[model samples]
Target: MIISNIAAPLLGLVDTAIIGHLPQSIYLSGVALGAMITSFTYLLCMFLRMTTTAEIAHAFGARRSDLAQQTTTHAVVIAAVLGLAIILLRPVILQLAWAVIEPDPELQRYASQYIDIRLWAAPAALINLVVLGILLGRQQAKYAMGLVIFTNAVNVVADIILIIGLDLNVVGAAWASVLAETSTAALGLWLIRDLLPPWRQWHITPAYFKQFGAMNRDVFIRSLLLQFCMAVMTGYAARFGAVTVAANAVLMQFLMLISLGLDGIAYAIEALLGAARGQGSRHKIRLWMRLCALWSLLFACAYSVVFWGFGDGIIRLLTDLPEVIQTAKLYLPWLIIMPLLGHWSYYFDGVYIGLGLTRAMRNTMAISVLGVFVPTWLISQQWLAEEHANHGLWLALSLFLLARGVTQWFYLKRHQRRLST
Candidate 1:
């Protein structure tokens, strides 16, 4: 799970690495802002993966192959609809992002170059989510990890050939992602042959639709709120100019690395807890919970130490631009403590998914994003100078993460008697 999770973020880092070295910072900034918009649009269907994993894990534990098949079919359909919706409404989406981000013309052009080509894979990307969800739900971590490794491996090679050899710039990066996503989705579907039934056997009933939607509803909103917060962070960073946004782009890749690496812990617990729930073993559930928390804390501490020690070296590896490098190092403290501050939210998100407590998950995220994140950033803005505004953004983001864990902990405490008994 950790290897798989880490590979996913390396895709972003690779994009950052290649684009960050271009003659101008706008290329990196464009992709940064463009990727933010892409994430916002495509990851809206993130619930396809989350709910699919939990529900399928529970079904797997209960030995319900039929249910798992049905869940996968439903997720595929939902993904198709949402992906198509994105492709159709992309212009409107871009307009909305422009209103909020107000990126300069050159940055916007680079961003548009990325966005226009990248979004064509919306269906493929979302389907891959379901493919991964199904793989993880069955506790087939090796295969799940293999799929991601294959995808990113393909992406890396394509990035090198197009960006370096062909000089396609941001368009090259975008195309590389498209090819990777579409091909990986195909490979994933084929690899799940054991789970895939005959065409005649696949059918979705009304009950399945209702159940799927119910499972997806809360987590759907949670994914959106989370993405919105990130988009806000990137959008605000863009306000500081191309150099600042480019520095942020590089820093955000590291942040993605931290978040996704910890997410491996979350993914593990999600599967383990769902299986425990299905088997009606509170002991196993609580046991996995404790272990997940302990391991995650250790991992978080290691990240903080690593960033504190070697972060500058890693930053230099990503981009050689003197201005961007200096600017990125200016905010090293936030990246250093980010894992420690943010790991809990990522961990508990898995707990909620596994326990079928996604409503509570959504509630905490609502409080974190709407109640804590935006307000903290807004309030800090009044006192923060323009040069230090990014710091304020990081502070709000850190507090938002802290607030999620705190609220989710209280909710779990309130329900402990029922849950444990």
Candidate 2:
């Protein structure tokens, strides 16, 4: 899981490197802009993956092969529909995305070309999410790992061949991703052939949609909240000027690294806990919780130590700008300790997803985002000097994460009696 998570991000780095080799900087900027849109739209739809994983895991735990099969079918259908919707709405999406971004005409042209090409694989990319969810839910870690590697491998090769060999430039980079996603989706379907429902047996009723929508509503909100907070952080950081914003970007990468490593563990927990909860096995659920906590804590501690020891060095490696590096160091402490405070939310997230208690997650996130994080930052802007305004922003974010974990903890405790029974 960790390797797959880590490998996923490396694809972006590779893409950037490939595009960076171009003589003109516009190619890189264009691809970057298009990729940002890809990230945002896909992010909003991530709930499909989590909800599907939960459904499959629960069904598996309960020994309901029929339910598991149905879950996969349902997810594939929804992913297809959503992906198609994205394709059809591509024009509107581009206009909306560009409105906020507002890049130059030349860069916009390059990015639009990339986006137009990339949208061709929207259906495949979205379906791949459910395919992965199915694989992970079955605890087929090796298969999941292999699929990720396969996709990345295809992408890397295509990027080299089309971008370098054919000199397709930005278009080649876009096509690489499209090819990778489309081919991987096909491979994923083949890999999960056993789980696919037969034509005569397939059924997707309104009840399924209703239940699925209910299950995913909170998850969707959670994704949106996370995205909003990220945008808010970036927007707020921009207030301090280019150097501070750049530093925040660098620091944000650190947070992403932390989340990626921890999320690998969370995924495992989701599967384990979901299966256990499905079976109503209190003992198994308790055991998984205790075991996951120990390991996740160990991993979180390692992140803190690495950041504490080499945070500045990592910053320097990311950029040669001394000002950005220096500014980033000023807030490095928050990044260093963030793992300790932030791991709980990630941990509890797995728990909630496994138990299929997204409403709890939704409520806690609302409180964390609106009740705690926003208020803290708003107060800080007025209370703290301009020089230290970013400090308050950091403080709000840290507290926001901590608040999520804490609130979820309370949720678990509040319902412990019912759950254990």
Candidate 3:
């Protein structure tokens, strides 16, 4: 699971590596901005994955085979509709992003080019998310992991061929992702063919639809806020200059690597907890949480140490540009501090997913983003000079993570009280 999860971020790392070595920093900057926008958009629909997993996991755990089948059917249908909607509405989405990001003409040209090409794969990309959730929800970790590895392997190979061998640059990178996603969705459907009910057997019930909408609504809002925070960071980075954007992009790849790897533990927790919840085993659920927390804390510490000790060496490997490297090094301290502050949220996120506490998750994320992240960002900007905007951005992000974990803990405690009473 960890290996597969880590490979997902390797796509970003590969893109940065290929584009970073381009003749000009503008190429890297353009791809970075475009990629962030695409990522945010895709993640905004991540309710498909998160909610599907929760629904299917509970159904599977309770041995409700019919309900499990129905959930999968509904999930796929929802993904298809949402994916098509994104494709049709992409122009509006792009326009809104452009207004907020406000990139220069050169950056705008490259970003628009990348986004336009990538948007065509929306249906395939969304179905892939549902497939992933279904597989993991059934506790098919090896299979889920295999699919992730397969998709990313194709992506990496395509990236090298298109970006370097053909010199296709940013367009090549976007096409590589599109091809990878479309292929993976096809492969996923084939793998789960037997598990999915036949068309005649599959029918959506209003009761199921209501549950689906309710669950997805909470997760959708939570995901929107989470992605908004990240999108805002990149948007703000663009304000500093292409060099700053490029530097932050490089650092973001490293952060993605860490987060995705740790997410494996969280993913496992989700499956286990979901099953436990379905079984109504309080003791088992608490035990799983405690053990996962210990292991996660140790992993978090190791990540912090690695970043603190090897930050410079890693920065050099990410980009050849002296200016980007220098700027990244200047901001290395925040990266080192981030793992410690943010790791808890990752664990709690898995817990919430498993227990189907998404409304609580939604509420916590709302408070964190609206109450903690925005205020802290505004204050940090005023307190620090313009030259230190990157520092302020990182600070705001760190606080957001801290708030998410803290707020979730409060909710969890309240939930426990209700259960106990």
Candidate 4:
């Protein structure tokens, strides 16, 4: 899981490297801005992935294969509808993004070019999310890992061939992602062909949608809150000028890389805890939580040490732009400290998803974003000068992670106490 997750972010790293080395830095900034917005939209729809994983895992634990199958089918259907809706509303979405991100006109043009191409893959991408959820739910981590690794491997190769070989630039990057996602979706379906319901046997009823709607509503809101924080970070960075946003893009990639690596353990926790919860094994759930936390702590410390020692070289590897490199250096300390500060939140996310305690998840995110992060950021802006505009953003992000992890811990302990009683 860790290996495959690492490969996933390396695709983004490849994109950043490809564009960062271009003669103009605008290409890199434009792609970064566009990708952030794209991620925001997809993440808002991420309930398809989380709820599917939780529900299917629960069904598997309860020995209800039929329910598991139905869960995947319903998730895919919902994903398809939402994906198509995104395509249909592209104009409005772009207009809204333009107002929020406020990219420079040239950067906006390049970003729009990339977004136009990539949006077509929405249906494929969302369906693939369901495929992954099924794979994870069934305790088929190896298959899920293989699928992710394969998808990223294809994406990297296509990105090189189209972007560097054909000189297609940003357009090539977008097309590369589109081809990769669509092809992977097909591969995922083929890989799970036996597990999927036969076309003739498949039936959708109002009850299925109702169940899905109920399960996903809280998950959707949780995801929206999370993604909104990210959007605000990216949007605010763009307001600081292209250099600030570009440098932030590089740093954010570092954060993503770390998150994905840690998520390997988180994914394991989700599977284990979900199954345990399904079977009413509170002891098993506690065991998984303890073990996952221990591993997460060790990994987080190791990453922090590595980032602190060799962070500069990593930045150089991402971009050749002198300004971007220097700007990234100014905020390098945050990257060093972030893993230890932020990793607990990532671990908590997996536990919450596994337990399907999404209302708690939603509440924590609201408190972190609105109650803690935003207020802290506003305060920081007043005290700091305009040149260090991003200091507050970084501070807010750290505080948000800390708040989330702490809040989740409180909730989990309370639940455990009640269970014991």
Candidate 5:
């Protein structure tokens, strides 16, 4: 799980390194913003991946091969449908992003170029999400790791050849990702053939359909709310000008790397927690939560130090642009502080999912979005308009992290007590 999560950002690191060296800063900013747009879109369907693992793992623990097969079929069907929907809605989505971010004309053009090419890979990307989830559920961690590594390795090489050798610019980066993801999806299908039932038996029964529908609806709502918050945050970043947006983008990569790496541990907890939940082992549930919390804090602190001490140098190595570097430096503290507050929220999310507390997760996130995120963002925007706008953006984002963490922890503690009683 660690290697799987790290491979993603490592792919971004390659793009950052290559694009950062381009002769112009606009291209760098363009790629960063473009990538963010793609990520936001892709992650909206992330529950396809997450829910699959949780459900399949639970089913596997119960020795229900039929249910596991049904889960895989449902996940694949949902992913394909969602992927198609995204492709169809590409124009509307991009238009909304443009309206919100309002990038410079040149940057906008580059963004469109990147999005246009990458959009074609939507089906493959979503399918890959389910594929990875199924593999993780089967406890094929090494295979899962290999699939991600293979995809990103291809991406890095393709990125270098397209961007540096062929001068395809931003489009090159996008194309590289599309190709890499497609390869990963194909390879993933081949690897997990044993887990899949025969093609003749692949049909969703009425009862199975009802359960799958419920899972899809619950998980989709949860993911949509999360993605909406992220989109709003990105919009705020974009409002601050290209350099500010670019700086935040670069800082975002670090956050992704750290958050996702920690998510590996969370994934482990989800698997264990789901299995315990299946067996109705309350003691094991508590044990998983405690161990995850302890490890989460330790990892968060270690990541914070790495970000504080080595982050600037890492940014400098990515790009030689003085302005971008300077902009990133001002906001470096947020990057360091983020893991401390943010990691717990992610960890708790896995725990909640394992306990089949999707409704609680959804409700807590909605409340945070309404009561915490919106008000804090509005206040920050007001302050920015008054003076020192850039600082206001960072402040707003930091508040979002703190709020999310606090609220999630609150709910989880309550849930823990309820379970105890």
Candidate 6:
């Protein structure tokens, strides 16, 4: 799981590295914003992954082979449909995304180049999400790792050839990603052939379908809230001008690398926690939570040190633009603080989801977004309205992290109490 999750972000790292050396910094920055918008869109549909994992894991644990099969089928079908819908809504999504950033005409043109080309990969990307979820559910960690490695490897190679060699610019970078993801989706589906039953025998039972639908709904809502926060974060970053936005984009890539790396641990927690819950071992749940928290904090501290120590060099590697480097250096401290406060919520999210506590997760996220995240963002915007808009953006984001950790802790305690009773 660790390798699988890590590989995906390494792909992005490679992309960033290549683009960082591009002749124009604007192209790099445009790719960053464009990537964020695309990522935000894909993340909004992430329930295809999360809900499928929980449903398939539970079904398999309960010894219901038919239900397990149906879960995978339903996930693929729904993901396909949703992906098509996103493609159809591409113009609308692009319009809204542009409204948020409102970049200059040239950068906007580049962003559109990236977004429009990448939109074609929507169905493949979403299906890949479902395939990953199904693999994790079946405890096929190695398979998942292989798929991610293969996908990212192709992406890196393609990115090099297209962006550097062919000089297709942003469009090359975007198309590289699309091709890699599409290949991954195809390969992942093929790899799961043995696990799936024959097509003729497949049918969704009403009871299993209802359960699957509810899980999907919960995860969909939870993911929406999560993605909304990310969209706002990206949008806010863009308001600070191209240099600021680019710096934030570089910093965010690093943050995501940390977050997703830690997620490998969380993914382990989710798998083990789900297994423990299946066995009705309440004590195991507590144990998993404690271990996850302990490990997360340790890793967070380690990440903080690495980023603090080598951040300047890292930023330099990403871009040669003096302003982008200078701005990213200014923001380095917050990058250090982020993992310390942010890692907990991610771990808790996995634990709760593994326990099938989606309602609590959803409700807490709702409160965090409305009560904590949005208000802090607005306040920060007002406070830094004249100069230093990025300051407000970072502060508001920090508050959002604090809110997530606090709220999730509250609900997790309540969950423990219920389990005890």
Query: lDDT of each structure?
Result: 0.86, 0.81, 0.87, 0.84, 0.79, 0.80
Candidate 4 clash pair list: none
lDDT per residue (tens digit) for residues 1-421 in model 4: 5664553355567788888998889889988888888778777887887788888889888988878878877787788889999999888889999987777899899989988888898898888878877888778888888888888878889988998899999999888888878998899889777667888877777887787787689888888888877777777888899999999999998898787768877777888889998898978988999999999999999999989989999999889999999999999899899889988998998999899888888888888889998898889888989997798899988888889899888988897788679
lDDT of 3: 0.87
Query: Per-residue lDDT for 1-421 in model 1, tens only?
Result: 7776654456567888998888887778887788878877877788998999998899988888888878877888788788888889879888888998888888898898899888899888888888888888888999988988898999999999999899998999899888988999899889776667787776778987987788799999999999888887788888889888888888888788787768989999999999998888889998999999999999999999999999999999899999999999998899898889888888899999999998888888998898999999999888999878889998998899889888998888888966557
Alpha carbon lDDT at 395, candidate 1: 94
Which regions of candidate 2 are displaced past 4 Å?
6-8, 16-34, 98-117, 159-173, 199-201, 235-247, 316-331, 378-393, 418-421
Backbone clashes, each candidate: 0, 0, 0, 0, 0, 0
lDDT of 2 at 167: 96
- What is candidate 5's lDDT per residue for 79-197, written digit by digit as tens? 88888888898999789889888877988998888887787889899989888888777767899899988998899889989998999989889899889988888898888777677
> Each model's TM-score?
0.97, 0.86, 0.97, 0.97, 0.95, 0.95
Superposed Cα RMSD, model 3 = 1.2
Ranking by lDDT: 3, 1, 4, 2, 6, 5
Model 2 global lDDT (CA atoms, 0 to 1): 0.81
Lowest-lDDT window of 10 residues in candidate 2?
A: 4-13
Winner on TM-score between 1 and 5 is: 1
What are the candidates' C-alpha RMSDs?
1.3, 3.3, 1.2, 1.5, 1.8, 1.7
RMSD of 5: 1.8
Per-residue lDDT for 73 in model 5? 85
In model 4, the runs with Cα more than 4 Å from the true position are: 6-8
Query: Model 4 TM-score?
Result: 0.97
For candidate 3, write residues 348-376 as lDDT tens digits. 99999999998999999999999999998
